[model samples]
Target: MNTQSLTKKWSKTICLAFLYSLSIFSNCYSKGNRIQSSDLKDSLISLLKKSGNDTLMIDSVYAHIRINRRRLGEEYKNTLLEYIDYTTKIQYSRGAMRMYDRLGLNERYDERYDSAVYYHLKSLELALELKDSFQMAYNYNNIGQAYRLQDINNLAIKNFHKALELQEANGNDKGASFTQNTLGAVYVVQKEYDQAMHYFRESQKIAVRRKDQRTQSYNLGAIGEVFLLRDQPDSAIVYFNTAKDIKQQMGDKKGLAVSKHLVGQAYFKKGNYVEAQKFLNEALVIHQKYNNERYIALCFDYLGKVKLKQNQFSEAGAYLLKAKEIASNIHSYENLISINNSLKEYYQEMDKWPMAMLAIQQNQQINDSLFSLKKTREMQALEIEYETEKQEQQIKLLSAENEIKEQRLKIGIAIITLLVLTIAFGIFIQKEKQKRFVLERDKVKQQLLRSQMNPHFLFNALGSIQSYMYQNDVKTAARYMGNFASLTRSILNNSAVEQVSLEEEISTLTNYLELEKMRLQSNFQYSIKVPEEMDIEFITVPPMLIQPFVENAIKHGIKNYTSGGKVELTFEETSDLIHVIIEDNGEGIDTTRGKMVSSHKSMATSIFKQRMKIIRDKFPNVPEPVIADLSDVNRKGTRIDLYLPILELTSTSNA
Candidate 1:
């Protein structure tokens, strides 16, 4: 497949892209409707099965392949790129090209239009070199698919025509038919309904002409898709049924699954929950059977809708979750957006405004990103064409003289690959940041949660006090009720501050400990190693973050200790952090299994750990509280070290 020329040409293109970062179209085509076939099915399957020796390579391949091929069949599409990477490194051009093509499809599925176009163009280059016109046409068709996904109809129409021409020229009837179908989609996107229907009819004719059941199924599905777009659910159902019959006859589970999904959607649109659920369930089984994850995700979403209508709240929630995972993993942006919106709706139904808002944000983010990408693709086109004007022209002249070298397309394809790779990298970083931000926000909520105490627990405490009062034990009941009132006051005070002043926080802890002391008189003693003149107020920490550890010390360690039951609290403030030390001379923790805690013995200790986890996740730089057994082997004692970064503030009042 001219490995040397391919590498050289690809490298040349990359070098130009790094400096320019633009995109160019080597050729254009008019839109056409074509039927789908199983031409690339074997190639997809073969690539999916390739597990390179390197696990990372396997992962990369799986990710890329999973991106594209997982929709067609139950095969792992994500792993395709990894295999292609290994194959390319090992100089397996055939496998590399297949992987490259798969990568483009992955990007296309991801709604990364520029990237998909770039990669597919490269695939086209390799296919043309290999003299595999069918493969080249496949690439063109995929590129058109990418554009179609982006709603770039002019370009989609153009690339679809290129594929159609190549397929027809090479007598690749199936390729031609499918390419024609895609063109119809572009027309639909452009709202040229007549042209769209014309292409669909043309695609159907080709499918029947070729007597290919697979193509016929896809043609029917394509018609259904258009009908669904027109909100003609009844008409869509008829076409979907036709597709289903053809797919079932051919034993093409994936095709049958999508058909059923369409039928489900049709029923869903007609407000027929029972029929929708039935068809959607059938679709789900078929999708899972064929490993058609994309369709499976779709079915999950529709199932959730059905469950929601049936008032099966838990079932609806479960299905939505599965839908989110599949849609996100598959890079089905539209599907992801839909799934997220559905999740938002579910949360809204539950009256969870915060969760609903969060889900809505996620859904909006996908839409925002797609919109941004569409804008970037436009800018990139101008940049690529302008920067590579000279080299591109030179390649054009050469291609005109000898059609044997479609180097321009190769170069554009290389550029597309680079663009997709870069965008993937950026998205990864953005996603991580988003995760961190969400974690931080939740930590803030956790820090504030105590203000809203559980009424039942409050009831129990008050009831205990009331029993004492009813028995004329006024002193004991008064002491217990006073402690409860103090705890409530601290909760209120803590709720008002985003972060706690070290001095005020320590005072709050002292109040809580004193109350516990009243409950278990003389069982424990505690002291804070705070300097009399130290400005503890200047050091801000997560509210109650340190208090939990101290509480754990009392409930587990000091309470059990027969002697030397003392809890020591110390604070050390430095330039960057405020370190808090909570050590008790009673009941050391079990060091086995990494400083294990018995939540059964002390729920306070367990809650402390959970709260700390939330803090660490929010403030990544804030270290986890370190636990150690500083006491002797048989001694009842444990020490915990917590390091909270100091808020960069000057005055205590400002905090």
Candidate 2:
């Protein structure tokens, strides 16, 4: 049972609206019971009508609904729906987005999970329209939580990852922390304790760093839950008490209630009947007051177990029936499972063999259904992994064939050049020239291989996939496999070429950066930009020229970043040269390479310099790359401007 509430954050605008609503709706807010739903609705409509298309005023009224959501209860949802309609009519996108999100969360609380997902998607669409990455991530997280509550593991994981990706890329540490906990909760449902703990600890670290007390409490409680699940009641009690203390200090009534319920469960597990009853009763009162059916059901179920342990058969039956009724009404399968088990035990105690058998069958059916769901998830994971491995093998075979063909072509060219030179010049002259040509070709080949597909990169990339699989993150492994394979294919395809179209080069670089992002766990953001008017398809540059610089930016520049790492590649052109500017908002060259000198540190750069020397021999006018530390006064990063001859392929050349 997920006792912890999903964390939510509002914009500064919402805080302002909260203040604004105090003056406008003070009576309705302070004396909620005295105000009827129809009166509240009319008052809200009057406020909206007065506000017209004024988004700020409309948002304030929306904020009022959110602030009084619990007090208004069912009426609050009516207010949100009306708010959404008003905002939609006026094309107030921001207000509409928030309304939909609030409505979705309300639906989730009411256990209308599919409706929750639908509203969150609606919110996401508006978030996208407004180009608000934070809001988009928020909606994605909300959708994931809804799915997770319904035990839809696959969709839940997909949405949670999407939220995490956006949050990390945007350096939204708070959002990332919240998403991490949600992901942990999913693994907990699946009984993947190790993975669950991994995520919970990650979230804890972020909460600690941010000094976020609420999040810290949530993490502590979650850790307690794991201990409870492992049958370590004493350890669970310690954590739950800590969480309860924190929430009490914060005066968080709702959070404190959940913490009390967890503590009660731990006490029951420890056979402390009096303390368990005291805490569970307290939790049940608060849950009833708040109309939180899920936690109420949980409280009742656990209370029944405690009473059953105390040999109060009649009382146990009463509590279990209450739990069953609520669990059934809310469609809480996990809670129903517990209630059914409790009912079975109670029936057996009463010597009702027929009733006991019915409860046993019901319990078994629920367990079987949950087991089948888990099995389906496992089978899907295996299928994805199998397909990924199959693709990897195919790519390897293709790469091997390409290598053999390349070697044979190189031999044929060498032979042809030897014959032509021997006929044109003296044998001695041919031998000297051939020796120099062979040495240069070998040097270029070695440098190209280092820059194109470094062994370390291949090893690390494959290792990342292996780690994901071992962690049972099959989706991530499959995604990594696809990117790795595409990057490998691009490297092999481009290796034989002297030059490639800028479009093709950019595509390869995108795959490389995407893989790096996944491998590094989205600690950084990257962008590739070209002028809208520029014709990249017709423009060619030396293969692997820009990649080394981009690699350096990632490996040495931003490798150690927790967040806010940025790499940008922009393409521009003059009459003679195409300029590829690679920039990173990371440690400058001096701090990165000079302070931490290593052989691998500048290997790509050194190889790229040598490669550039070779390219300059063919295009004599090409300029050497310019390296600059972007650390004048305000910012610190490395910028490298690589100049290349604008090589364009003619129609005949293409043929």
Candidate 3:
């Protein structure tokens, strides 16, 4: 939303497009002259004037009225919507106009342009229907403010003129003067300094006469703006200071801050470097305290100018970039364009050719887009007017028939399509469920097989140790046999369930690796290292998770190495996730055969996928494990990295 839009929104009530409201229009509902009574109406209407009944209440009330009144037909709905439409016209309900005007004003200040327009336009419709001059003026003013924020100054001017007419009609000379001051603001944006001052001065006179301190401050600040634009720093300072004093006297902190900031700007405009910094820094704090990003960006922009003048290129660039980014985010075209143009000049002065040219290009593009949107909006507005007139004619002839025909056609097609889609979707879901059932049954059977095979493998290893002992070669096979016992117990313990602690899983790997090392005779050395800080016991990873990867590296990679062959397993935690890297310094990979051997591609990758699929069935939200090789760089090695999020499920929860 534009500042102009905000201004229009508030101004609508003040200018009398909307009136200060007091009444809650009761809803009357009927079907064929038999009426419907609702119980919620009295309780809701009693809240109408309550302090906090803002936009939400307003919308709720509108909905309630529409529903309880059963105002569905064109005539009944139009009666209610007619009240809505009048806010945009010349008439208004006196109290209703004021409510909309205040709403518009608040929304404008809060940067809620769309909301402001909605309320102001609603006020406008009511004002028009009631022929209430006060409210009509308010709505016009608010609408104009909205147009102003939109950068549609022509429409803003037109609506402002309409507001002025209504203000005069209502004998609100003071209000008329206020609208004129805003008109001056529009001119200031247009760079028509002289005309801006003329309207501003006229507004100031009325404020001074009426003893309206707030308006007086606004007028003073506005005049200061015109002087600043004209490069008359001294005059701008005088007006800004005057505005500050009045705003302070009125206890308007926001107004005071705005005026003081402008005074700082005037000093910057005058090229008094010392004076400029002094005021601008103060202005920056004030704006920050107020949380006003728009004015804050403005202050920074001026500060950047000062920095550029001092040849503080780095500082200047920082301030400019900050201002440019904020202005772009807020959609403040006027400020953005000005800052960008200034930055182009500064960058060029510093011989930063690329940045300077880019700034120039962006500035042009922004303005072009703004202009194009303005023209498109105008075309649409014209089309709407034409359609509205056509619609009125359409209402008198075949309107009921047309509506019934369109509604029935749409309803019947929608029902049939929805039914067909529902049936198809049901079929798809049922088929998926059946497939999952079959897969689950197969998975349970396989789980039993893997569990049984691990114990049998442990028995074979143990029997080998016993044979060695019988031959009186105890020392030779003692370690392998002990490892086999530990491995068997761990496998039997965890194999009955789906998951085990990372500590248990790693221990299983250690036992298996010990047995492998005894058999392989250190042809390729291997090591396991896990960071102490990693919560191994807390991580409930799958059982036998690391077994297959070890099998792959040793059988495939180390088998091809002649010398200096090694495999290193490391587990660490980073960024709240567990990271595991399995690497080997061996003949990394082979492509000699017509196809990849089982050692490299089959057991680890395919079985790992099955395990992952089962894990996903239980933990569907967790991401799949990452698998990648870090071998190419060394060429003498292969490295595989696995990433798993730090899912610390308790042993009990793992079930």
**Highest-scoring model, lDDT:** 2
lDDT (10s digit) by residue, model 1, range 1-655: 5756654554444334322211111101112211122322343334335434434323323332322342334333434544665666765566667667777766765667677767776666666556565566677677666656655566667667866777666565556666777677677767787788887888888768756555567668878878888889999999999889977765556667778878989999989999999988987887787788888888899899888888898999999999999888889988888888788889988998999999888877878998898788777655644543453354332222134245446768999998997787986677576334221000101122352345644676666665665565655665565456445533532343456556556656666666555555457667777754344634566666676676668777777665457888888754346778888887576666565454443444566667667766655556666788866556557888888755433220100
> TM-scores for all candidates?
0.41, 0.43, 0.44
lDDT of 1 at 407: 48
In candidate 2, stretches whose alpha carbon ends up further than 4 angstroms from where it belongs are: 1-126, 267-333, 346-351, 364-655
> Residue 320 error for model 3, in Å?
2.0
Q: Residue 138 deviation, candidate 3, in Å?
A: 2.3
- The TM-score that candidate 2 achieves is 0.43
Mind giving the per-residue lDDT tens digits that candidate 3 earns over 1-655? 7766654544443223112111111121122323223223333343332314244334333433332333233233333443344322423245345556555655675677667766776666554555455565667677778767766676677778877766655556656777888888888877888888888888877667755566677788888887787789999999899889876655556677787668877887787887878777877887898789999888888888889888887898899899988898899888998899879978898889999999889989988998899798777556543553463354332222343455567779999998997787987677575334221000001111143344445566656665665565545554454344334333322333555456655655665665665566556666788865344645555555556667677777688655456778898754334567887766565433422234445544576677767756644533554333345464565666665544434211000
Off by over 4 Å in 3: 1-42, 45-130, 378-655
User: What's the alpha carbon RMSD for model 3?
Assistant: 31.4
